[model samples]
Target chain A: MRNSIITILKKELKRVFLDRKLAFAVFIMPGLTIAIIYSLMGGMIEKLDDDAHEHITVVQTINMPHDFRLAAEALYGTGMIIEENEPTEKDKAVQKVISGDSDVLLVFDENFIGDNREGLPGVTRYANSIKDFSIRGGYMADSVLESMRKNILSERLGGVDEATVFTINREDVAKTEEKAGKAISMLLPMLLTVFLFAGAMQVGMDTIAGEKERGTIATMLLTPVKRSHIAIGKMLSLAIVSLASCLSSLAGVLISLPFSNTMFGGGFNFSDLAYGVSDFLLLIVQMVAMALSFVSIICLISALAKNIKEAGGYIAPAYMVILVMSMSTMFMQPEGVWSYMLPIYGNILSIKNILMFKYTHTSGLISLASTILFASVLAWLMVRAFYSERIMKSS
Target chain B: MIEVKNISKTFKLSKKQRTLDGTKNKFKIAVENITFKAKPGEIYGLLGPNGAGKTTVLRCIATLIKPDKGSIIVDGSSVLEDSREVRSKLCLLTNELKVDPNFTAEYLFGFFGRLYGMNDSEILKRKKILFEEFGIDEFADVKTSDMSSGMKQKLSIAISLVHDPKVIIFDEPTNGLDVITARAVTDYLKKLRGEGKTVIISTHIMTVAEKLCDRIGLIIEGGIAAEGTLNELLEKTGAADLDDAFFSIYKKTRENVS
Candidate 1:
């Protein structure tokens, strides 16, 4: 049995890898292309950030309050250029912002600063939301006005310090770690699962359905080997291929990290990622299980189809369903053991837990065991399809 | 020796196939109660037109499919009970046996040879002979996609013969080949018969049947309309040749059915 499977695996891998064009298209190009594209996107983001600082235009700031002036000066210390323009009519100031010539238009009321204020002091900010720089400038102006309001409130409250009302200290290491972990969990599992499925679908359809379409499957089936051996051999090869492709895609995502960090203003330090070897080993194990399950799904669908086109039609819906399932994890509450019993959903939750460093041994084992069971069932169905005369002859 | 007894097969036609057939009947009787025998050292030909159940019978004999209500025995092994044993004893070829576009002939030959449990040296030995016999040695290393159709056909024939099975079966062996390549295949069939291997083929080519088959079976409408040697069929139908003999048998069978 082992010999038969090895023989079949050798043949399939040879056909896939020896063809230079197919090897490049399926295995190499996806990762390399994605890495290059994301890197370029990161570069564009960095350029936009640099250009945003020069775009702070503050109109009609001659009567700005003392507290607002102090806040605006602090912004200048941080390298923001808050240019005070000539006092213009309200309509013209708004028009300049609308035309993208300026980032913000601030109009203060005539009784803006007074000893006895009758009406509530008001400031109107006109900024185009469609422009990122204008939006940033608008947010900065709002912060300055908020600081002035806080100062007025302190004076009204008999010299109580404004900062004493609410002191937000976010220097706790555990809390910060949890926040980072939550963010990573919300996004990475969905991305990883989608990438693994995409990688599997790219090659798995051709493994069986393509052979059936070309009539070469008959040649393989006529051999004296058992049908189960053929199914196992094909599924194993597909899993390995898909896992490698997913890793390549992951490498693409990782290679673009530094640029993305600078672009998004996260300033995450790569050296601060304190995951140990065991953590990665666990992640690798989960990824392999996830990949096997995905490959089994693709192979079963491919086996049921009469040709590659039919397999493609079947695969599109499966991809959409898996994508939706993976996306559901972003909002899914960490439920009890029952949630780990679902198929794709369970695998995804397990991956999320592992990445966030919040997985329990019981939940992890159940999820992994469930995934392996599901994969085994799918593999069995594929073997049954292999033995079916109707499926083989229709091809 | 190959013995097929009361072999019958029925296919449930899909909606599309039924529409093409212009009938509401959901079943198509491909082969019904068809039986024949082929002895060693003889070339037996099944002569029939398209959709005459010839390929179905061949598939049944090769154990690629089982009959609906019958049994087949090849080399004293039951096809239903011991298909694996049957597969080891015979090789089946049809136009549907396509070459993988990526691999070369040499690669496929070695691959199938190993599956049949032959070691590297034995596979190389058989490959050398078969390639030489089919005149495929010159282009054996070329990828199948780059080869011409005739060359691919030759390569397929060589690959099928790689295991040196005792029985060989083919459906429409020369359907799409140039005369030269077709002749090479027919010549190899004769050689296999000379080496005391039982060979069965299905074709509608009268000249091929009359020239090559020691015995011929005329199949019509999923049944064997007549079975005998060329001279016996010719005499029984009082026709000039096998073509006229086939027409006479076809007309008699159709009239009786109606």
Candidate 2:
């Protein structure tokens, strides 16, 4: 039986890899698509990072008191530059914020010093309509006001050498850096899912559907081998091809990493985010399970289709489902109970968690088990379909 | 040897929606009470028109489909009980010859040989002999995509015989071949008969049937209309040729039924 299966697999692989067109479809195009996707994503991330660090010209109106101006100068050091403009009214400051002439405008009210005494600093920051930068500006303004209040309290305490009354020692939390690194880490799993899905469809659909279209399936069926053997062999061949494509895509992503710092404008490297031995092993298991799931699903679909055209039709909805599941990881962190129970959902979520250095054993195990279960059921369905009269008589 | 006894098959056709509203499906009998026998070293011809159940009967013998109501025993193994063994003992060459366009003739030939349980050396030996005999050695390494229809047909025939089974079945093998290729195929079938292999061929061409088949069975609709040796059928129908005899049997059966 092993020999028979191996023979079938050899023939299947030969039929796929030996043809120039299929070879290109199965190997080259998928890797190229992966490179293109990661390249685009890396470009977007770089653009965002560049926007975060770009020089910002902050114009302060004359109503801004000496204390607020001093705080603004201190806060804008290195990260952002605040260029004080000539005296301007409130409406002029708002116009500068909207017209992109300045990153922000610090407007102080006429009774600013009196308001500080009354415990309402009354400061307004004007910035462009961009959300992230605007939020960052708001946080900066709040910090400056808090510092000024602490200084006023020190002066009111009679200057008896107040022991650093508002000693705010801000430690480097590293969360933002970790978040960016985690984004880079998620690249593999996302690419893995896409590549495996595409590879399975490319190889499996072409294996069965192409044969049916070309009228070669009936000839293979007429051989002395059992239909079940043929089905298993073909599915196994597709699984191997999918695994190869996945590996190729991973290689493509890894190869593009050195250029990522330039592409993403931050010092992010995939090698820097590498996991330990145990974690790496778990990832391998996840990938194997993912490849099996993908291959089995595509094999089942291919069996139902009569030809490549019909197979192409069937795979469109499959692609949509996978695409939605993969993109969901980007917008939402995998947390809810339902997220752990779904098959591909769990797989992508686990990868997200792993990338963020939050490892959960239960989630990984459940995802792997679900993938295996789904693969078993689909493989069984595909085997049964090989015995079906429609497949046998389709030619 | 091959034995088929009282094999019947039925196909259900859903009723047309208009006049047959709410009606259940009706069955069309494709093969009914068909019985035949072929011993070693004989050629049995199943002669029928387009939908006269010849291919269906052959399919049952090949174990590609099951008979609704009968058994086929090939080389002492029942098709239902030991289909794998029956498959091993026979080769069914259908008219639809589709080879993987990516593989060379040599690759396909060797692949099928391995599937038949032949070892590498044995496959290599048979590959050379078959390639030489069939004049396929020149295109041995050429991809099947570039081969002509006649060449593909020949390659298919060679691939079918790689394991050298005791019984061979052909369903309209010469349907699309040119005259020269068709003659070559017929001569090859005769050659298989000479080697003491039981050959069953299904065809509507009277000349090929009359020249090649030792015994002929005329199938009409879903059952055998007549069966005998060529001379026997000619005498029974009082016809000058096999074609005339075939029409005579068909007309008599139609008239009797109507």
Candidate 3:
């Protein structure tokens, strides 16, 4: 039995490895294509941010107070040199802002520091909101003026404690780790499930359905090997091959993390994505189990189909169903222990927990057990299909 | 020896199949009460028209499909109870069986050889002889898809015979081949018979049956109408040749059914 299974696996692997086109599609394209796409996206985002910075212009009124002027200069840094322009008339500065030349116009009343706080003159600000850079510059100028107001109030009130009125200080459990965990937990699980299914479908649909369509299955069935051996052999080889294929896509996701992060505004540093070796090993276990479950389901469908075209038609709906199921990880929070009993959902949740460094060994084990149990049942169904002449020789 | 005893097969026609077959009945009888035997050192030919249950009988004997009733035994092994043992003793070739198009003839030979538990040396020895005999060695490494249909047929024959089973079943062995290739295949069947192997084949080609079969069975409408040596069938039908003998028997069966 072992020898027969090995022979079948070897033949399947040879079929994939020897066919250069199939190899490229299954093993190389997923990673390489994603990397290129994400890198382009990253470059576009960086360019947008740079363009926003370069086009910003801040304008100040001539009678701007010395303290406020010093604070503005400190805040703008080298930006003040390139962007600051003295306007001979207040109307001209307003006009410049309206014309899109200047991003913001700041006007101050010459109150000369009157102690009547209620009647004190206020600063008037104007900017074009249609231009994004103008809105950003206006916000910056607003923040600086608000700080000056707070300083004046503090001085008048004999430097009263700000905490007595209102204050907020964040206390998170390891902020950097929390940020990385949240980002990866949400994104990686969804992408992992998608890639795993995509990989399995690429090869699993062709495993038996293609053989039946091309009439090669009769030759295989005529062999002396047991039907169970054939089923297990096919599932074993498909799972391993698909795991490798999914890993290629995972490599794509990992290698392009920085770029994808910038695109999605995750802003995660590459080092923040670090997972320990043991954590990765656990991930591999989940990957293998997930691949097995996917291949078994796909193989059952493929065997039940009359031909490759029919198999393909059957598989598209399965893919859509799985994709929708996996998408649950994005919006739906993982439920109680019952979530670990679900098939694909369990695997996704387990992966999410692992990425966030929040998984317990008990939960991981339950997820693996559930996936394998489901795979075993599906594989048994596939074997039954192999022995069903009505299904096998339908055409 | 091969024995098929009253084996009948009925297929439940799916809606699409019913439409294609143009039948309102849900069941189609592919073969009924089909029985035949082929002894060692003799060639048995099943002669029938298209869709006349010839391939169905062979497929049952090959264990590709099960009989709805009765049983088949190949070399003392029941096809139903001991299918694996029967499989090891026989080889089946049909139009419905094929190699992966991307695989070369050599690769398939090795693959099936290993499945049949042939070690590397045994596989190589058999491969060399079959490839040389079939003229497969010249392009043994070329993909099956790249080969001509005749070449692919020849390769299929070689792969089927990799384990050199004692009983060989072929359905329409020369259905769509060039004259030369068909002759080669017919010659190979004779050689197998000469070596005292049991060879059962189905063909509608009168000349092929006349020239190759030591005994013939005329099948029509899922049942055998006549079975005997060519001379005996000719004598029974009071016809001049095997072709006339077949048509006469077919007419007699149709009249009886009516």
Candidate 4:
């Protein structure tokens, strides 16, 4: 059985990797696509971070309170090179925010300082756009007003401690570097799912459908080998190719780890993220199961299709369904029994859970087993189709 | 040796129009109770027109398709019970000549040799013999897509016979070949027969059938109209040659229908 599968795998690999165009699709193009995507993402993130930290021109209107001005200078002094401009009216300031001349505008009401003992009326914050800086300015303005109110209360209480009057404690909830590494790890399963599905479909569809289209399959059918052997051989070959594609894509993803950390602000240690021996074995099993399921589905479609064009038409919907399922793992938590029972959905969800360090061994194993079972049934259907008189007669 | 016994096949076409619902369409009989045998060292020809089921019969004998009725036996092994065993004993040369453009002739030869369960050394030995025999030794390393149709056809035939199956089935072997290539193919088939292998060939060309087939089966409308030696068929139809004899049998059948 091992020998037969190896033979089939060799043939499949030859079919995919040896064909210059197919080789490009399987190996080179995918890596290039990953690199391009990562670069674009990294560039966008850098641009956004730069915009957040860069200096901005502010036109203060309505005579900002002394305390508010001091607060603004202190906040903007860190990285923002704030430039003061002539005071503009509130409506004009709003208009200026739209014209892109100023990155932010702060307006204080005329009786703002006089009402320092009490809460002040609303302060209008504006910008050419509602950008991150403008939002940060609003927060800064609110903090300044709150500090003035606390001072006024302390004065009224004759030097009593401000802690009894009011207090606010802020705790940082941002993920640490280790937790951030874990967060990025959540994408591993999704990447694996997408690559495996894509590889299997690409290779499997070509194996059966392309052969049929080229008229080589009919000649092959004339061989004395059992139809089952051919089906197994082709499936095994597709699985190997699919696995290689998945591994290559993984490598591409890993290569961009530093960029991913820089873009997303994480300190992910590559060594920490490496799979152990047992985990690696489990990953292989899961990937094989996924690859087999995909190959089985494609082979069945190929058997049903009259030619490669027809096979492609059939495969489009299958791809859409699997794509949607893979993406769904991103939005939902895989805790329910249903998520562990569906084929591609279950497998992807289980893999996602595993990558996130969620204890989902049972679910993952079940998903793997069910996918293999489904693939087996589909493989049988393909074998039966091969044995059918109609297919041979049509040929 | 290969035996096809009383095999029949029918295909049902689904109605295309909704308005024709509930109306029963006739089932098309591709092969009806057709039977023949090929002994070792003999070339058996199945002569027929288009849609006469010659290829279908050959496919059945190759065990590519299961017959709706009856059975086929290759070297005393049942096609249904032991298809793999039967397959190991035969090689099928189909009409369509397609080769993977990526693989060189030598690679494909080695690949198919291994597929037939030939060991590494055996495959290498067979590859050498086939490349030399087909005079494609120089071009063995050239990609198949770069080869001409004649070269591709030669490679296809060589690949089929690489394992030296006892039974060889060739369906319209010279369908698209030029005169020289066609002559080369027919000469090769003659050589195969001479080497004590059972050869079953399906063709419409009467001259090629007459020159090559030791015995011929004339198939019409999915059934064998007659089967005999060249002289026997000529004498039976009271005609001078195979073509005249074929026309006489066809004319008699058409007249009987009228």
Best by DockQ: 1
Query: Looking at every candidate separately, what fraction of the true A–B Cα contacts under 8 Å does it contain?
Result: 0.65, 0.64, 0.84, 0.58
Root-mean-square deviation of candidate 4: 3.9
Query: Of the candidates shown, which would achieve the greatest lDDT relative to the real structure?
Result: 3
TM-score of predicted structure 1 = 0.94
**DockQ ranking from best to worst?**
1, 3, 2, 4
- Every model's TM-score: 0.94, 0.85, 0.88, 0.87
lDDT value, candidate 1, whole model: 0.83
lDDT of each: 0.83, 0.80, 0.85, 0.76
* Residue pairs in clash, model 3: none
Which regions in candidate 2 have their CA more than 4 angstroms from the true location? A58-70, A77-185, A261-274, A326-367, B12-27, B256-258
Clashing pairs in 1: none
TM-score (chain B) of candidate 4: 0.93
On the 0 to 100 scale, the lDDT of residue B112 in model 4 is 75
Report the number of backbone clashes for model 3: 0
> What range of 10 consecutive residues in model 1 chain A has the weakest lDDT sum?
A262-271
How far out, in Å, is residue B17 in model 2? 12
| A198: Cα error in model 3, Å | 1.7
Worst 10 residues of 2 chain B by lDDT: B16-25
Task: Write candidate 2's Cα lDDT for A228-320 as tens digits.
Answer: 888889988888888887777777676566545454334554455656787777777787888888888888888889888898898889888
Top candidate (TM-score):
1
For model 4, fnat equals 0.58
lDDT by residue (tens digit), candidate 1, B7-110: 99999889999999999999999999998899999999999988999999998888788899988999899999999888888999888988788998989999
**Span of ten consecutive residues with least summed lDDT in model 3 chain A:** A78-87
- Clash number for model 4? 1
Model 1: per-residue lDDT, tens digit, A1-395?
A: 58989988888778678888877876788778767887888888778878775554554353455567676766555544454544555666678789887777777766687877787878878889998777887888887777677667777786656535766776656645555565566767887898889877877888899989999888877778887888888888887778777788878777877765543235445555566787788788888888899999999999999999999999999899999999889887757898888776787898888767787778878888899999999999999999888888864
Give the higher-lDDT candidate: 3 or 4: 3
